[model samples]
Target: MNKEALIALGLTLEQADKVIEGYGTTIPKSRFDEVNTSKKQLETDLASRDKQLEELKKVDAAGLQTKITELQQENAEAKTNYENDLKASQLSSAIKLALVGKVHDSDIATSLIDTALIELDTEGKVTKGLDEQLKTLQESKPFLFVPEKKEQKFKGWDPAGSNLDKDLPQDIGFNFAKEANSKGAPAEKALNPWGQ
Candidate 1:
């Protein structure tokens, strides 16, 4: 199980190494890789911003001031874009987690969800209309969800609940000591494998 193969499957270096160490066990697609890639891109953007700042320092005072304003605006736009992307990613992940075990077709179910109305709480839980929307969808489009399983109630005797003293006849069970004494054998011989 090569790390490269695992990495190609959208795993990080650490994740790929762990998989290799674990003998190449199957792993589902990871959101961590997406987040990690985004983080690296953000770092690269910051590095470029730093380089631009250094270049701006070498320019005339008027040009440097204009450049500073432009860079600030660009930074603001980048921040907004990053925030929006992060929120969208969070919303998608939250929806997927919520839909698990409930939906038959996750892609269809997720598409049915009105993502615009969904928001995440501070604790990362889906809040402010997601649950209500899911409930509404579950009612209107029942086919998208897995069928609710009905539990069968057993009418037979439950061994775990039954008491042997009450259920079994007193004479039906054997007593080794009584049987051996009746046969004229000693109690010691009946009870112990090695008689003293």
Candidate 2:
């Protein structure tokens, strides 16, 4: 059934496989074996070259650690900048909202806010120039000036008369037990009925 067995019987092997199956007939045995061995050698050589290339491209531990540290530092700086920018944006937006109907356009509002924030401190407190700009804006556009909100002061809870003591029995009394401390002071203790 195979070509090699037929060749051993002193008969030449004829075409037995179809060309559509990607196999060629009438190939010499020696040639096929040589091609197969050469193909395997080429594959092995390619794998070896690929491994060497990978070794060349691979980073050392020190280089990789340096890159990681650099990326971490960059990320930290970016985070800090983003936080600062976000805070500035919020401040600018608050000012713009205060100047809603006064400015002719948004650009004017932005410019006014920027001018007011020129001397803003690191804590975002407007320490200088903000009040003057606000006053100027207020005088020019009185409707846009919003008065500062007055802080509401709250009084804490007070135990007031609820007629609680008025309706209680007049003969009622608190009988607390007392103990002698190391300092010889009469220290009050709870009136424990179980003698605990």
Q: State each model's CA lDDT, in order.
A: 0.78, 0.61
Candidate 2 C-alpha lDDT tens digits along 77-97: 999999988877866765555
TM-score of each: 0.49, 0.35
Clashing pairs in 2: none
The residue pairs found clashing in candidate 1 are: none
Instruction: Score candidate 2 by TM-score against the native.
Output: 0.35
| Candidate 2 error regions (>4 Å) | 1-50, 53-59, 103-196
Question: What are the per-residue Cα lDDT tens digits for candidate 1 across 1-196?
Answer: 4688778889999988877787865444576688788999999999999999999788799977899999999999999999999988888888888788989988898888889988789877787777798789989998888988999888866554244556653331234444555565665545432221
Off by over 4 Å in 1: 1-60, 154-196
Residue 1 accuracy (lDDT) in model 1: 40
